[model samples]
Target: MGNWKLEVGRMAMYMSFPVVLFHYFNQPTYFEEWVTKTKRNIFPPENPQDKEAIQQLIKDMRTKQIQQFEGE
Candidate 1:
């Protein structure tokens, strides 16, 4: 648009802007806490009781299936 010097400066700014942003935001210290909090929110901590109940349900289903096979 302007002189050669101005065109080179504009090109440098366009290329360097994303490089600078990527460098800043990609640092672990910049985003680790947010990532951890987001993960916890998406997957709440498991409860011992819930784990036990799931295991018990699976056991009961297995036993029931075994009995059904035996009857057949």
Candidate 2:
């Protein structure tokens, strides 16, 4: 009876370990909120140079898309 109880305890310990590890490893450590906030704050800049840089970036992206569409 003691051995059976010990075996049950060990089995429970083993089963619960994986569950604890799964929760510990799979739990969300989120970053998207702060990253999005940082991105939003950077744009529509007060500096003229920064605004021009953003405009050029958009133009370049549009040009790439147009080239891709023509290629296809």
Candidate 3:
């Protein structure tokens, strides 16, 4: 069997291995681009045409609703 020092060293290694990995991997610079790219892929930038179309659709719905209430 090993001495106390050897046992302590083993325990320290077990505990610190994950801590060291977390410290290095949690840095934003390491994965910020990756996260941003994934976000862009999931939700691409909105286009002007898409915005205009959405506004027009909303306006049409509102107008139709007003007309229905007025006609009733």
Candidate 4:
């Protein structure tokens, strides 16, 4: 009877360990929240000139490439 009780206790502990681990692992930890908040605060705001500058640079590069191809 004592061995049976010990076995049951061990089994209960084994089953509960997974539940405890899952509870902790599934929840967001402090470091995760800190990193998320830090990233949100550190991200750069979109600039109005960013798109225009990118488009103009691409156009200029294409034009330069075309000129080089024609020269060749």
lDDT of 4 by residue, 1-72 (tens): 578889999999999999998888777663688778888889866677997899999999999999999999
Sort by lDDT, best first: what order? Answer: 3, 1, 4, 2
Candidate 4 off by > 4 Å: 28-46
Error of 2 at 71 (Å): 20
Once fitted onto the true fold, the runs of candidate 1 whose alpha carbons sit more than 4 angstroms away are: 1-11
* Tens-digit lDDT track of model 2 for 1-72: 578889999999999999998888665566567667788888644888888999999999999999999999
lDDT string for model 1 (48-68, tens) is: 999999999999999999999
Lowest lDDT sum, 10 consecutive residues, model 3, at 22-31
Error of 4 at 63 (Å): 0.9
In candidate 4, residue 18 scores what lDDT? 99
TM per model?
A: 0.72, 0.39, 0.85, 0.57
Could you tell me the C-alpha RMSD of candidate 4 in Å? 3.7
Steric collisions counted per model: 0, 0, 0, 0
Top lDDT model? 3
Superior by TM-score: candidate 1 or candidate 3: 3
Q: Against the hidden true structure, what lDDT does model 4 obtain?
A: 0.88
- Sorted on TM-score, highest at the top, how do the candidates line up? 3, 1, 4, 2
Worst 10 residues of 4 by lDDT: 25-34
- Pick the winner on lDDT between candidates 2 and 3: 3
Scored by TM-score, the top model is: 3
